[model samples]
Target chain A: MAAAREFGVPLTLVGDRERVEAELARHDCTGLDIELWHASEVVGMHDSASDAVRKKKDSSIRVAFELVKGGEAAAVVSAGNSGATMAAGMFVLKRMRGIDRPAIAQLLPTLTGSTLVLDVGGNVDCKPDHLVQFAVMGEVYARFVMGLQSPRVGILSNGEEASKGNELTRETSVLLREKPLNYIGYVEGRDVFNGSVDVVVCDGFVGNVVLKLSEGLAETVGKMLKAEIKSSLLSQIGYLLCRKAFNNFRKTVDYAEYGGAPLLGINGVGMICHGGSNPKAIKNAIRFAYDYALKGVNSRMAEKLDESFPKSVREREANEAPADAKERVVS
Target chain B: MAAAREFGVPLTLVGDRERVEAELARHDCTGLDIELWHASEVVGMHDSASDAVRKKKDSSIRVAFELVKGGEAAAVVSAGNSGATMAAGMFVLKRMRGIDRPAIAQLLPTLTGSTLVLDVGGNVDCKPDHLVQFAVMGEVYARFVMGLQSPRVGILSNGEEASKGNELTRETSVLLREKPLNYIGYVEGRDVFNGSVDVVVCDGFVGNVVLKLSEGLAETVGKMLKAEIKSSLLSQIGYLLCRKAFNNFRKTVDYAEYGGAPLLGINGVGMICHGGSNPKAIKNAIRFAYDYALKGVNSRMAEKLDESFPKSVREREANEAPADAKERVVS
Candidate 1:
């Protein structure tokens, strides 16, 4: 709220106005205006949640998405069910040309800086060509969002050495190594932190696991350190003396530091904020979405789609892809 | 050095004897006992690390292993190349009976508590029986280490539905579910943090990917939080006022909280500490190894092996197992 108010952006509370007002108040954000978009009780916000956009004419999430889609709002921000938001984004705005599936891309913090991990949970089972597409999209996002000139693309595999990992990762690495992008060879899980690859691509199943595991570890480590420090008065005093250094260390590991993740390959700027997100994260997600829109991420993705995968690969997939494979994708 | 002196655990310093002694004096660890196992030359600790273990019989790592093997020391601790440590362990101490591949299992922090993640990076391509063995080993380790009775084993898959995941996870899930242990059907990556499953199992390739990704995310989130806390004076004050709480948060996310991960299924108590471990982590790793020895991990693993897998399955593997596979595995 402070960031939005600092930038002089008009902020409106779309859903449960009282709750939004109370939350803003807790953050001391009264300067940002609030409005209640109270729809008819009979045709309330829930109707707009479905991809069938016609169902709910006044659903809060649907109305907010509509504001972004119709240009009334620069960007839409929501902390609701991600599936509903993704559905509304696609059903109302649709996918970009030449893009087969949408991917959820996140700016993962690394030892060097931050790396982009794509398809975190959007697509569970990914074809080799779809992985290639994700690599291209991830590269572009890194170049724009993270300001990398030529991002290194890597397929997250079990091993860095040749002939390591399962069949899918091995095959994907082969395809990525053949691509024209600054594609590196196979990268292990450690490479994600070592800054060997700017864009790490994996199927959503693996990607989701990686994201959650990292979060869990971070929280665990943080708690353990405090317990250690609290065990003695001298340690507690030592913590206070080096508070600045510890604070510096803390800043490097926070999730809200990177803002929210962008839902890539979609037609419009769609962002998914953390469910327990505060005002600061919400403000950052909006800023990220605006920047993505300003960079024309969708059109650039369309232009780069062909360069990502060869025509031969596409033809092979078309011929060999099972008729029900797409439907078989869990999410 | 400060914590060790306070805790009364005599610490040993390796590498250059004179230089280490000088550094210890510099850090006021002069009272602490220090020893040096000088090699013929400086080991890169990365490239020739494995060779150092294989050829250099008097190297620091080798000496440390011997100390443990000969019962001169309770545990061996080294923050060197994990592959080298694992190699030295397998070659020196060997694997347990009926256990083909030795699994490196680590405890991951979760909301409910810490859950055991097996095969962090031990074996990439694993057979279904290998996973079953991991289940038995994990079940026993959890009972001894985490102290959970009848730990629920959930094979990591793309979905919770039994029929989901790749061929390996699916087959493993079936075998695990049918076992007498508390097999909890199938679980996804989310379940690792969801606190629903006590033991999350996967092939080494997938497990390593998950582990690295988790570490990377924690580091990222931890850093981001620190940065945000310092972005403004208000946040700094908020952070300062909650200094105890913040440090508590920091400890929770730190990797050293749970100490080292034991390379289970090995003949001896071989624990692999993280490469970036500090003195405190080394202490904990030593403590964990002591507990492991006291519990007789190998005996328990050996006891469970013959009964863990069905008679028909073991007979099938024995008949169909490749010659080289047999030598590498069930020796």
Candidate 2:
């Protein structure tokens, strides 16, 4: 809603009528092209993503996605159950043609601008081809959405060496080498924050753990700092003096600053926000949804997939064969 | 060397004769009952662990581990190549009886206190049995060394649900439930820093990544704070005032404070230090090694394994059966 007001974009709020109205009344939302669409239910955070989407047919998440599917809304943004959002997206928008699996792409704040990490709780046991598709989509998102001319893509592994990861990573590395993206072999976990690559791809299991661990660790560090500062009068005074610098530091690591992650490879634009997202995060998620739709990232992903894997019989043959023995060259 | 001097214990310094003498001279180790044992070779940081151990038979790491195996030293500690250290450990000390794989356990600083996370880059592809052993060893270390009674053990996964992780985690969770330790089931990555459990067990691949990623992010956050503070004159003054608090915060999160991770499941005590460990970190590592030897952690682990997996034919039969259909009840 804040994004709509700030960007002067038309927005439709889908949720319980009374609750939505109460929230709107609490804020000055006047003169903004905003409409409230009523939904009878909500998917709780602890609820199973697929089960909730299946049961709550008239859920706010479902209703919002319906609006996008019906051409009433260009995109849907939700700071709710992530699994439900992904389930609703797959159920409503469906996967793009030729895309085997969809991935969640999250932008991690780095010393340099940011690095896009994919499969952040989207697919758990990803195959070699699934990771290849993520690389292609991630590259497109990096170039078209993040505005990079050539994005360096890397498979997240235990070590930077090609032979350093588990079976999935080793297989994915072989496949990524065949793609058109600037595949940079493998990157260790430290490289995720070091900004060594634009896109770091991994199975959803590892990516999800990495994402949540980073959030938890950052919060832990902040809390530890506060506790130490308050332990002594001298440090307390020091903390007060450096309050501005600390606040600036907090902003740098704040999840709100990066907004929500985009559910890539879905047919339509869907932004999945952290469940603990504040108003600013919600606003940024909406902005991302709007920008993703405006940029036609999904369409571009489809094009990139087509370009990388032509529909010719030879292309299918190449995919069927072992990655190292591919006859046709990838463009 | 500092720990040996401070603790009034005799110390044997292993490395090149000239380098050891120079280091001792630089550190003012005048009358500390320290003897320098010369080794012709040193394992490079990037050297393959197993290959280096095989080739550099007279390397410092190899000689140090040999001392423990030969009863000349009660324990061995090295602030050198981790891979080489593990290799030297396995080659010299060998795995404990009934232990399938050795693991590295590191103490992670949490909000409340600290959480011990195991298999941090020891065995990359771990079996369910390996994780079960890690749980037992970790629990013992937490109790005997860290002074925690009945430490809660949890498996690190993407979700809290038993069915949420990959095949390895699911299988490991089942095995852990049958163990005598305080098994708390599946814990997500966030729980690692939340201090929700005393021991978080994971495959070495995931554990290593989490360890490195945390270190990298903590450093990144520190760097970002420094940069933000120096961006303006006012913030710099605030930083000076808060410098004491920040230093305390750094000490709290410092890897040196926790010393080094123990190489569990080995027949002898071996502590692995960070490659860039300073004199303080090395001193702490030596202290930990001495304490581990005094506590007889390895002997206790052997006894625990014997009790957990009895040598009776019935116990062997139970181990052979599927996890769900085990005949004999776990003690």
Candidate 3:
């Protein structure tokens, strides 16, 4: 409803009809371009991705993906079970050209502005080639959606040297160096928040770990600050005096301001949001999805990725990508 | 001087003679048991680890490790290039049995107290068995060194569910569950700080990423707070009012308070300090190394790790660990 009021774009709300209407009714969603598309079932967080995707046909996440697949909706954004959302994306929308698997590219608040970190939990067990694709996909997301010209791309490693990183990152580094993107050699984790690079790419496991850890650390810092402020009478008085400054700091670092992350390398705009996101986050996500569909990011992303891969690299990818990973792509 | 005064452990400072002497001369040496060992060469931050390890034989790090190898020194601690330090430890101190590779375990301040996260940057390319070994080594470090009764060992994953990790973690999780330690199920990155788990295990790539990212984020937050405080008159006045509380908060989270990470699974203590460590961090690291050597952590760690790995798991590791990794173990 906020998205409808703000962007004035028609939104097809897909979920249980009663719940959707109840949420909308809380706000003055009068004369808003909002349509309720009911889906009977819901995908619980504990439900396995594979089982949810295959059996829960009428699940909101599954139905939402179907809307995008059938062109009934421009995009599908859900703050639901991400695993189920990812699985539904693959089973319903398929993938883009030159891309073997889809990845989730998330925008994180950085010192300068924002940076894109890919595969937050799309494909956990990625091969070197899969990581390379993630780099390419992340690059496109930064360039087109984020509107950066020749975005500085980097693969996250322990060190900034070429000789750092695990086997996967090492192999991916070799592939990235040959690509046409503005490939920065290597970046440490601190680089993510420092805004040293525009796009930071890693396998799903590392990206997800970093993402969650950052969130946890930020929250912990907040709690720590509050405790420190309350420890002394002067600190409590000082905190009250500087309450405005604290609010500004919180606003700058809050993840809700950034909203959802788009699942890149897919056939359409499929956003994966935080399940506990507030209305502001969901509203921003809807606006982001609307902008993404209007911009045709998917087709351009596919085109750029296809062009980036030479014949030799493509062949190398096929050989390097493990065969067993293909069967285990559900999660 | 601080460690010597506090712990009364005689200290041997290894580095260029002139520099070490000058540093020690700053403080009173009348009643101090301090010895300075001279070295001709120093490994610069940019020098390759292999080149420094193999070519710079008389380098300070290498010379220091040799002191440990020759039984002249109980443990070796250096605030130098971590890669060079790691390589020197491998060259001078062969790994403990049942541990194919030695790992670095660093202590991080948590809400409750502290949590141990291992393989911060030791072995980037790890097998499932290698990760399981890291878990065992981490468990022993927590129990014997950190003095936890039975460390709640958790393999770092994207989610807390059993079906959550990547291929490496998934396989490692299976191995961890079979061990005799107080093995917790998979833990997300957020668990590293919430004090929900005692020990968090992951490949060097992931662990290193988290460690550095945390450092960067903390620094960034500090900067953000300063900027926020400066933006307003009330905030500036409030900062002076609560300055003591801020200083206390800083001390609590400061890395110097905890000191360097131990190079676990090695024959003797090999402490890896941050390159930018201050006098406080160096002092703490020396004390930590002295405590580790005194506790006979190496032998106990070896015993526990060997007991944890069954015949079948060891065989599986020998097969699963890639052949080429054995050749490229230098870095």
Candidate 4:
């Protein structure tokens, strides 16, 4: 909310008016110049997003996505059911032209800032072609959204060797290695935190697992340590003395430190914030959506896709010809 | 170390004779009745386990694994390079009969006690057969080590739907569902904390990522909350007054609360404790190792592998057979 205030974007609350008003009051933002986009109901919980989209037609989540689709809103930010978010974003906002699927690109916290892991619970069965597309989309998104001029892309695999990983990753790695992006062969899970690669691509199944596990680990370890520190009077005093340093360290690993995940390769800007996200995270996601809008990420993705797959099949076929035949085709 | 003393395990100083003697005196263990197992020299920091095995010959780590291998020690315990430990265990002790790959199983702290995530960075490119082996080993280890009977086994996937996960997990899920074990079809990352399943199986690649991320998330959330608590004087005072309750909460989520990961499917009792493990963690790991050794995990794994394979194969083949061939195989 502070980031939104700083950027001077109107804040929209898409939930129950009374509850959201109470929440805004709690945060002292009730009368502090924030707008509410009231929706009568919330989406179904534990139900597939298809059901939500079909049933909850006037739901806040669906309405938010509609606003973005209709260009009424620059972006749609939600901390609702992740599956529902992805479904709504894909169904309502739609995929970018030439892009096979929309991928949830998550920024993971590493010792050296954040690395983006895409398809973080978007598509489970990612084909080789889809991964090639992911590499391109992730690269473009990282450059535009994350401001990395030339983002390094890697296929998350079982090992660093290109031959490693399951069938999907292996096939994807082969295709990625031939892509025009700054492709960095196969990277292991450890590489996600090593700051070696700017973007890591994997099927949504593994990506979701990695994201959740990372979040769970950080929470589990921090809680355990705090318990140990407060167990004794002396340690409690010591914790008090080191409180500032501890908070600093905590901020370094916090999930909200980076904004919400952007649903890359989508036609319009869409971000899925953590369901338990505070106002700060929602604001960050909105800011990200605005920045993405300004940068024309969708157009860039379309251009890249067009270049990869030209309008004329003859030209595409000639370009895709063998290396030796490439000279003849050019001549 | 205090826990070990309390548990009545004879403490042994395994280092340079003079330094060991000096340290023993400094720690007041000189009069506490402990033994000294002196090595010729210290294991070089970056040295391989084989180097320590060959050169120092009596280094603590090497000696401990030797004790387990030679039946001189009930179990080996170490908080060293996990790769090196697995390497040493493989080379020195070898795999148990019928076990393809030895897996490192780590416990993930959930809201409800804890859940076991097996193959947490042991063998990366695990095959379907290897996964079946993991399930058997995990079940035996959980039953004996964790005291959970009829542990629910779920293959970690993108969704709870059986159709989810990669080809590997899908095939493994099919194999698991037909097996006699309490097989749940597929589980999501959140299910790790939901107590829906006792044992969650995945290849080491996913397992390693999940394990580290869980640890990182736990630490991150713990620190964030601690920071929140310390942000205000009133909150700080409240935290101090309720420090005991917080400590109990911390202990609930502590990774060390579950001790260490047992390198299951190995011939001998071997445990891989975290490298950054403190003394309390070391003590707990030792206790887990002792329990594993007593339970004859290796023999049980071997037995389970031998009995489960043909049954699993027959069942899979029967289920997979054409409608006409079904009766022939059954008959």
Candidate 4 chain A weakest ten by summed lDDT: A322-331
In model 3, the Cα lDDT at residue B291 comes to 77
lDDT of 3 by residue, B112-184 (tens): 7899998896577789989888888898889888899988999888888777787888888877788888988
User: Which candidate number would show the highest DockQ if scored against the true structure?
Assistant: 3
State the C-alpha lDDT per candidate: 0.66, 0.79, 0.80, 0.68
Instruction: Please give the RMSD to the true structure for each candidate, in Å.
Output: 9.1, 7.4, 6.6, 10.7
The candidate that achieves the highest lDDT relative to the unseen native structure? 3
Q: List DockQ, one per candidate, in order.
A: 0.22, 0.60, 0.64, 0.18
TM-scores for all candidates?
0.67, 0.91, 0.91, 0.68
Candidate 4, B1-331: lDDT as tens digits: 4545665554444556787677656664533435666656545546665665566566666665555555445556667666666766666666665566778898877655678888886476678989988888888777776788788888888777654578788889877877779887788777787667899998887887676555545554455566667667755765665566566766776767766788876667667888788777887876666556555666666667667775544443222111111100000
Candidate 3 stretches greater than 4 Å from native: A22-27, A310-331, B51-53, B309-331
The docking category that best describes candidate 2 is: medium
Measured by TM-score, how close is model 2 to the native structure?
0.91
lDDT of 3 by residue, A164-211 (tens): 777878888998888878998799999999989999988888888989
> Candidate 4: how many backbone clashes?
27
Candidate 4 per-residue lDDT, tens place, A1-331, comes to: 5754577655555777888778767674533345677778677657677865777877788887776655556666677787787787677766655566778889986656678998886586678878777788888878877789889999887656554576777777776766678888887776787678999988787888877666655554555666677677766775675576567767777677666887776666767888788767766776776666666777777677766645433343222111111100000
> Model 2 clash tally?
1
Fraction of reference contacts reproduced per prediction?
A: 0.35, 0.73, 0.75, 0.25
| CAPRI quality level assigned to candidate 4 from its DockQ score | incorrect
